[model samples]
Target: MRIPRIYSAGDLAENTSAELDAAASNHVGKVLRMKPGQSLILFNGSGVDYTATITCVTKKHVIASIESATEIPSESPLATHIGQVMSRGDRMDYMIQKSTELGATEITPLTSERCEVKLKGDREEKRVKQWQQIAISAAEQCGRSKVPLIHPITSVDDWVDNKPEDSLGLVLHHRTTQQLTGIDKPQRVCLLIGPEGGLSEAEIESAINKQFIATTFGPRVFRTETAPVAALSVLQWLWGDFNR
Candidate 1:
């Protein structure tokens, strides 16, 4: 039988016992109904998975003894950072989950001119925490040893101001004459996607002025949530780790 894998926030070391967090304990004890002496794997997003067996099970807690660890390398050779404008409802959540599964190294939720999802104060913090959790769970399910970092929500203008010079930066805009596959080999890339309503003309112009190249994915228009995943897939097929 295949052992169930769980992602925890605790420190893991070989020949040591680590207390499973309450959430994981509940999952193993109640959800999975894993009894003592059963085997499972644990990962702390440290690029290694700890092989462990259940040592004790009680009403209040569950403990596992680590047997050994298998070192896992990072997924992608060419890193892609997706800078997506926040969309409404579950749109952003779906984007983050699928992007993590597709091997996006980093994700930034940008608040752009067309963003309809307004978050203020505590709500912003709550949403960021939720999105980060989604990313972690997606990594765990998708067999990624390390979870992608979900950056704190920021404005589009601020993000454009701090973009790195060495990375290839491209924005998804229909007006652009260039296709995504036309780009040459680049070690790292940053993808900028607009919100549901799409980026205003002025916003696109401003991004172009700041040296962000625009690229399209053929003639059909894709939704805000779907655009990043399509672009990432094409990018991976053309010049990234997917070719391996």
Candidate 2:
């Protein structure tokens, strides 16, 4: 059987025994029905994988003993950050999950002129935590050693303005003739995508003034959730591990 992989929040060390947090414990004891003596791999976004064997499983707790730890070099050399405008329903969840699987290093949910989702206070906090867990699950399934960072919701202009100087920024729109293939490979890329109705003309212009190049896939316009997957995949193929 394929040993299930899980994400642990606390630090793990070789030959150490630790009690898993409630979420992990619940998953191990209730959801997965994992029993004592079964082996599982654990990662904490620390770039290390710990081979662990369950020592105890109970209604409220699960304990594991770390057998060994190994470094995982699964990260892509090309760092890609996506600034995605917020969407409704499960679209944001879908976008975050697929983006993590596609090797996006960081994700910043944006509030745009056309944004449909509004989050604030406790609701926003809860939503971000939910999105973060989705990223963790994606990392586990994809064999990624490190989980992608999910940032708090911010405005499109704020996100674009705060990008690192060396990051090559690209804003997706329908009018642009520029394509991903036309650009030279950079060490990092910060892609800006709009919401359901798409970014406003002024929003696109602000991104351009901030040195973000306008990019278009074709005449077709992709949904907020679907565009990131296609764009990131193409970018990975061109500049990341797909080339290897």
Candidate 3:
């Protein structure tokens, strides 16, 4: 059987014991009903996977003895930072999950003029935490050692203006005919994806002014949740690990 992979927030080292966090503990002890001596893989976003054996299982805790450490070289060369306008319902959740699987290094929940979802204060904090968990779960299932960072919510303008220097920026919109061709390879890419109703003309212009090239996949426009997966796949094939 395939060994289960679990993410641990705490430090992990070979020949040491690690106490699974509450969520992981519940998964191992209560859900999986794993017994002592069963093996599992543990990753802590450190780019290393720890081969561990369950040592203890209790109602409140599950402890594992880390047997060995293996460095996983699964990170893509292209660092993709996705700024996605928040969508209603499970769309945002699906975006985060698929983006994580597609090797997005960072993801920011953006608020655009057409965005329908509104989050504030404690509710916003709760949502961010929930989205982070989704990223973590995606990383675990996709065999990624590093989980993508789910940044706090920010406005479209702020996200556009704050991109890292020298990183290529692309704003996806159906109105543009620009494609990703003949462009010099970039070490990083910051992609801005608009909302269901699309970004306002002013918002698009502002992104262009900030040096984001307006680009599109094709004639067909993808939904807010699907664009990241489609765009990231093409990006990976062109400039990331897929080519290698």
Query: CA lDDT of 222 in candidate 3?
Result: 95
lDDT of 3 by residue, 40-147 (tens): 999999999999999999999999999999999999999999999999999999999999999999999999899999999999999999999999999999999999
The global C-alpha lDDT for each of the candidates, from Candidate 1 onward, is 0.87, 0.92, 0.95
State in Å the error of residue 242, model 1.
Answer: 1.2
Q: What C-alpha lDDT, on a 0 to 100 scale, does residue 161 get in candidate 3?
A: 88
Q: Pick the candidate with the highest TM-score.
A: 3
Tens digit per residue, CA lDDT, model 2, 87-167: 999999999999998999999999988898889999999999999999998999999999999999999989999989999
The TM-score ranking, best first, is: 3, 2, 1
Model 3 stretches with alpha carbons more than 4 Å out: none
The TM-scores, one per candidate, come to 0.93, 0.97, 0.98
Could you give me the TM-score of model 2 versus the true structure?
A: 0.97
- What pairs collide in candidate 2? none
**Ranked candidates, highest lDDT first:** 3, 2, 1
Q: How many backbone clashes are present in model 3?
A: 0
